[model samples]
Target: MTLRIRSLLEQVPDRLDQERFETWLETSALRIERILSRGHATPAGEWYDQPRDEWVALLQGAARLAIEGQPEELDLAPGDAVLLPAHCRHRVSWTDPDQVSIWLALHFASDGTPQPGP
Candidate 1:
């Protein structure tokens, strides 16, 4: 099969009224996705409780993330990242309104600790 190459920064919609999630790859135990947000926030009183661990990185723009039990919300800029353990309740508190926020997220089995591939 021929190898394919793509750019993440290209082909993004010019405007977003709601957050968008695009899955790039997936397996039985893992998934990789790209998310786009513009002035997006989780609904009031809503939180995400996932069964898998998630590692998310911001590629463009900025955002705020609030986690359950945390006293302060996390402000993330380009290149910033965080790992959320399985079942960790969290939500997007805010995203840049004038610019699109691009994020790369990886989700894997709760116990699939990352290790170097041989």
Candidate 2:
């Protein structure tokens, strides 16, 4: 129980390492540092991927995530969160190129193991 509790605690970051994420084991669960990117869009258009429901937040800076084929834009900043449906197609409309972003991504697999991504 103590271990699981620790897993949910706010992470201590070493931004210099610049690593994408961390995987920590918990009782019947997993904790992971999520992957984030500072996006810069010169000329925006529709780009997309299959629906994979997930959570994303802006840990630093600001940007707009627009659902593909949709007209509304979601303005995001630090501490803001959105739970996108698995089939949602979203694109980054803008971003701050001058700063580093820290994001926490959490994925809970039914088998209680971390999902590794490239």
Candidate 3:
């Protein structure tokens, strides 16, 4: 089998009307993705409630994450990481508009129990 190698920071679009999601790997129990966002945010009042747990790291730029019932949004800079458990409501509140914000996200299988938020 041929081995393909690529950089995560390569091939970014010059202009983005919306956030771009690229799945790099997937298995029966896990998935890895590269997400690029610029001046993007979740719509007002919309939240994501996923069935699987997620570990997301900010590889470049900046962002803010808002979790349900949280008094304040979590600010993220490069090298920052957050683990979100299944059924935990969350949303992207902000992303840097001047530069592309790169995120490496890993979603994995989780038990039926939902985890509490901070």
Per-model CA lDDT versus the true structure: 0.93, 0.57, 0.94
Error of 2 at 42 (Å): 10
TM-score of model 2 relative to the true fold? 0.55
What TM-score fits each model?
Answer: 0.92, 0.55, 0.90
Off by over 4 Å in 3: 111-118
Q: Write the per-residue lDDT of candidate 1 for residues 2-55, one digit (tens) a residue.
A: 999987788888799779999999999899999999999999999999998999
Candidate 3 local Cα displacement, residue 4, angstroms: 2.3
Tens digits of per-residue lDDT for model 2 on 1-118? 3533453324534343332445543333434454444545424666545334456666776777788767788888888887655456777677655554555555433433455643
RMSD of 1: 2.7
lDDT of candidate 3 over 6-65, digit per residue (tens): 999999886789999999999999999999999999999999999999999999999999
* Residue 87, candidate 1: alpha-carbon lDDT: 94
* Count of backbone collisions within predicted model 2: 4
lDDT of 3 at 110: 77
For candidate 2, what's the RMSD?
A: 8.0
As a whole number from 0 to 100, the lDDT of residue 118 in candidate 2 is: 39
Candidate 2 residue-wise lDDT at 15: 41
Which candidate should be chosen as best, given TM-score against the real structure? 1
